[model samples]
Structure formats: C-alpha cells, structure tokens
Target chain A: MTARAAMGVLLASLAGGAGYADELLPYRIEGNAVPVSLTGKPGDAARGRTIVTNRTLGLCLLCHSGPFPEERFQGNLAPDMRGAGTRWSTGELRLRMVDSHRLNPDTIMPAYYMIDGLNLVAPAFRGKPLLTAEQIEDVVAFLATLRD
Target chain B: MKRFHALMCAVVLAAVAGPAGSADIPLDQRRSGYADLGRDTKAMQDDDTSNPASLGVQDGEALWSQKAGTAGKACAECHGDAAASMKGVAARYPAFSPARKGPIDLEQRINLCRTENQKAEPLAFESRELLALTAYIGRQSRGMPIVQSDARLTSAIDAGRKLFTQRIGQISLSCAQCHDDNWGKQLASSLVPQGHPTGYPIYRLEWQSLGSLQRRLRNCMIGMRAEPYAYGAPESVELELYLMWRARGLTVETPGVRP
Candidate 1:
C-alpha cells in the first residue's frame, strides 16, 4: 500500500479502538442550548484546570484571562474569567467551546472541538480535532465551578 | 459657553485618540520590538563590532566589487559606490516594476540585476549570498524614513491589506486580530507589537542569524497554522508593500536586533 494509504489505515485502526469511539460526537445547536453526549465518565475538575493552563494543550491563557495568579502576562484580547460560572451555564459554555462561530460568526475565539472548514491544517492534524470529547467535558466541568 | 467647552473637550479627545479612536494607537506612539530588546541586544545593534549582522554586510561588500558572469561586470561598475548611490535606496524598495508588471522587493530586484544585467545565475532566495547582499544594501538606508510606493501600486497594496485582514487556517485568526487589533496585549508571555516591516534582513535572536522579511512572514503563517506562500511569491511581495506603506514614516533599522 502507498504510504498515505497505510497511514490512513493506521489512523482508522486507532479511531476504531475502544476509548476513541467518542472522538467524533454529533450534536445539534438549538438557540443557545448545546447538548453534550460524552461517552466517558463525568469529567474531573482538577484535570480540567491543568488543561486550561497548559500552553501546548489548551492555550486558553493566550487570549483569555483567568484567575490563575501564578501565571503572569495573561492575554487581554478576550473577556476575563473572574466569574465565568455566574456569566454562563454549562450548556452555553459547552456550545461556545465546541463551536463559538455558531454563536458569533465574527468571533476571534477558536473552536476547540468542531473541525470542519479549517484551512491549511497540518498533515498529521488534518482529520483530528484539537481536543477529545472527554477533555472538552473536563474543561466544561472546571469552568462550571468558577463561581464569583 | 458650557456647550462650547464640551465641544472643545470632544475635539481635544479626538485629537489625542487619533483616527481609530482610543483603542487604536497611532503608529508614532507604538514602539518597535527593537525598543523592547534587552540592554545586551540593544548594545549589539548599536556597535558594528558586536552586531552579528555586520558579518553579512562585510560579505556583501566583497560580493559587490567581485566580478562575475559573461559580462564581467561588478555591481560597483554600474551602481558606482554603494555609500553614495545606495544611500536610502532600500527605503524605496518593493517598488512597482513595469518589467515585472508588479511590486518587487530588493531581493527580486537583485536577482533581476544578476540574471539580466550581469548574465549570471540568479541567487536563490534566502541564500547566503542574497541575504548578505540585501543586508549590505539595506544597511545604507539605516535611520532613513521608509518611502511609500508610487500611486501605481495602489491595487497591490489593497490586495495586501485584504490578505492581512482575511481570516484563514485552523486557528482562524487574521493578521489584524493580533497585530492591528490587540497590539500591546500579551500573548504567551510576549508582547504583540504592531506588525510593521521596518528592519528587514534583520538579525533575530530566535533565528540566531540574518533573515529577510519574507522569512518572518512565513514564520507567522506557520504560527497561525496556515499555508505559507512560496518565497518571491506575488502575494508575499504585495504584503511587503502594504507593510512598508503602513510604516512609511518609521526609520529603517537595518540589521536590527529583535527578540
């Protein structure tokens, strides 16, 4: 088989594995409500906090400010997260994380989950999303706890 | 009398805010990454002996006088002394070229001179010889304000502006989002400066070597997860033209040190 075809087979096998079944989940957007059907168990808030601050993984601090006192030089391009839990519901936040463009077409925020219509994606990342569904749930779980 | 006082206050506020209002700072007020450089790097740029880019300039000087190709002509033979003839020449580059039927940067112009005039092989883009020669020529224009292109390049400039503002890549961030909109804001522990093309063929601390403006543009494209245009691509030239136009009054800091 060609190298590309072989690579495709490898990716297919990986996607077919037990844990990766939830990698591609489909959901409909109705107004501001976004229902998430996670195949994994409920997310851990601690894991979510780590993901939010990790530069290589989430890069959330690049444009959004949060209450992470240890991290200096947080970006101010987006809204600050002093009381994000009070501002948005879990479903609303999940929708924004999955595909913010659905809410505001002109938003500069990146869609962490939805993968369609992306341009010039790197070869290894072509068919993959930035974060898995479980990671998204974890982030949502953590964000939901940030009450004022 | 009260209404007049209010009007005067509004006028003063607008004048202080400039054209884009308070959110958009004027170009003159914005500092180049050069200003943000640490003392050691700043000192390196100030003195020729400490500056690494001076090495490229020295190589370029040798290449300038050396004769090559079937014509047996040196750059000095036609252009005369670079000090006198090349002074402020780099400031006017990416000029509209009728022969090329578009805007062409100094690198392309050099390649044209080599191939057409000297009957020599064109230097590869980003090659050692090209970077050195470009650095040499650009060094002559150091401290001079960048010159805006002639009216003929309006269409190309417009096209460049579109590319700058157009959203692309997986991140879906346009150049305007960071450079124009959020300049002075922090991103990943670094301050995002206005994306001006002032000191090109610059000696970047990151690259640890001299590189052209196109190389920097390509880096930004990769950072945004977008496909970068090929070197000497027309689109790249257009963007260069726009950037130079945007920084029309900014002084050239050739071989500038940047973090």
Candidate 2:
C-alpha cells in the first residue's frame, strides 16, 4: 500500500478497534466533535492550493506566513507554515490544522471540526458547519507537501 | 423659589442615577431577546448579593499593603488607608494632568503611583498586579460620582467622542449604534447595556476575572470587527476619557461583578 493508503488503513483499523461503527459512514454527524468532514484523495495539490487561496476556503495566509510566493498582505499571527511537512508528522499536522485551538486553549485559531462548542451570534447561522468535508482533506493534502 | 431648588436637586439626582439605570439599554431593544437593564439594575442595587469582589480585588489589597521595590513604601504609606484616602479618587480620573499634557485615566495614574509613590516598577497593562491594584483602588470609589471635567482636554474628549460615534471594523457598528441608538436591543446571548461607566474595572463572569475599561473596549472593537487599539494607546485613553465624561455623575462601582 502507498504511505497514504497505509495511514488510512491504520486509521480505519483503529476506528474499528475503538468500536466506532460509523467509521466509513458517508454522511457526517456534526456537533461539538465533528467540525468538518473529509473526502479528498491524497496528492490533490492543485485543489489544495485553490482551497488555501480561496477567501471562502482555507484563507490560511490571512493569519500565517505560508510558501504561497505570490500572495501578499499576510498576517503574522501564527507561525510560518512554509515547511509544515518537515516540522510535523502527517497525523500531527492533521490534528493541528483541524483544531489548533484544542492544543492551546488561548490560541486565537478556530477548530475546523468538532463544531458544537462554537459561539454563533446569529441564530440563522447556528448549527451550520464552517468548512465542508472534501475541502478539509484537500487542505491537509496541500499542507503535507510543504516539506522543502 | 424654594421649589426651584428642589427641582434642581431632583434633576441632579436623576443625572447621577443615569448610568446605573441605563447601563443595559442596547440588549433590551435588539432582536436577540438577551438583555434587560432593569434586571441588571435590580441586581446592582442589591449590591450585597451581586457585587462580590473578584480575585483582582484580593490581589490589589495585598499589593497595596505590601512593601515592594526601592522606596520601601507600600501603597498604604503614601495613600494612608485606601478606604478613606482613596475614596472619590477614581471618580475624578481621566481628568487633565498637566504633566501628561493631555488626559490621565486610572490606568496611567496607577502606573504613575507605582513609579512615583511606591518607587516600584510600573505594572504593565493587564498584568495581574495592575488589574488587582486598579480593582482595589477602584473599589474605594464605588458609589462615588464619576466626575471628570476640563476645558483644556476638549481635543482629547472630541477625539474620544468621534471614536464613540464612528463605526470601524468589519461589523460597521459604532459604540453609539448599540449604546446610544438601539440600546435595549438584543445581540445574541447577552444584553448590550447603555455603555455606562458606572460599573467599570468590573469582573465579568465570561472573562472569569476582573478587567479594566480598556479591556472591555478592546472586546467591543473586536466584536465590531475593528482593529483593537493597543493597551495604553492614546486612542484608548481618549475613548476612555470620553466614556468617563459620558458617564459623569454616575456612581462608581469598581471591583464590580458583571455577567
């Protein structure tokens, strides 16, 4: 199996061992724990890049320095993400990108998943998710490639 | 003629009572169904029940009594019993200080005292010691009038007034929009009070700690999606001065607890 496929199998086996019956469920069960779902294939670099720059997508550069050479007006709120793949394992990067707030309670970052604990000012927007499942997977794939 | 004096007294009383009664105006009128100034007032009026001092007050009291730094002078040495010496002190802050050549709010004054009187290091803004001492000193003036005034300070006051009125940030809502125009309106889960300065340096339950007027102002700016002024920045000082002026005559409620 490819590294990506191996990781997926490991995750699936872990989920099975943990008795999470909904491991392969297509539909998402969002709440305080399921912020966003993922369905992107590995190596989708072009789509990942699109998500990073898309204002409605990742918007990662808004608060961090990234290797997007053409982008300007980025904020220095978080650490530079130019070499994220070298700095963190795929699993660690996955967790951090998913919800950096969980690691540092005082961090200003938002959780991409586990949505139930958010503060929604307007009721019309309540219970609605932030990012879609495929978008998260694509973004992760893009982040995993930033080794050099 | 005697009735005129009584009428004047009533007016003065009404003016003094303005801040407390009107503090929660915005939340009541908004669509959120979140706030009620009347309830807040009722809770405030029953101070023994609602106004339990926060940890900041306790820390401040310790700092006030403790001798620190080179001068070997505790705040008690120069101020001589905070309850008596410091009473009404805060009510007069955000006033003109010729040395500063502009405005001197409570935070600046605290730093000044730390440097000049206590001969200690100036506490940084939002520092535990600073917040504590500020809370303690403010508690001394609880129930006194917020009485800032000056002619030379008009420029700063004007700047502050503009800030209060001007809308900034992504939300495009000015302080006046909620506090003045649509007070008693609901936002979400909370009430937007009339933007009174009465219960300042209050311990907000949401914050889980005591915070100064500047802290509250920053939070509001963030809510408006506006860039926050740095702590101790001139804009924040100007804004605070204006708030003090707007909230004049209202009794101070330092070390106050709020939701």
Off by over 4 Å in 1: A1-24, A38-41, A69-73, B1-30
Sorted into a CAPRI-style docking class, model 1 comes out as: acceptable
Query: Scoring each candidate complex against the real one, what DockQ results?
Result: 0.43, 0.02
Give residue B152's lDDT in candidate 1 (0 to 100): 66
Per-residue C-alpha lDDT of model 2 across residues A1-148, encoded as one tens digit per residue: 7999999988877754333222232433333223333453443767888878764446566556677777766555457788987877655665565666557654445455433454322332233333444566667778879897
Candidate 1 lDDT over residue span A18-124, tens digit each = 44443468776667857554534667789999999987778889888898999887888788876787899878888888888888776778887866788766554
CA shift at A118, candidate 1, in angstroms? 3.0
Please give the TM-score of chain B in predicted model 1. 0.89
Question: How many angstroms is residue A14 displaced in model 1 relative to the true structure, after the best TM-score fit?
Answer: 3.8
Native contacts recovered, each model: 0.59, 0.00
B1-259: candidate 1 lDDT, tens digit per residue: 7777566545533332323211334666866667767799899998999999999999999999999788899999999999989999899889989987789999999999999999999999889999999999999999999986466676777678777777766677778778877887778677888877778898988999999999999998887777888899898998898778777778898978777
* Each prediction's whole-model lDDT (CA): 0.81, 0.65
Candidate 2 lDDT, tens digit per residue, B1-259?
A: 7777566545533443323222323322322112243477447534644554556677888988999778888878777799999888888778778897999888799888779876888888888888888888888897787775555676777688777766554333467756765454344234446677676677676787677889999888775445788898888999998778776667786766667
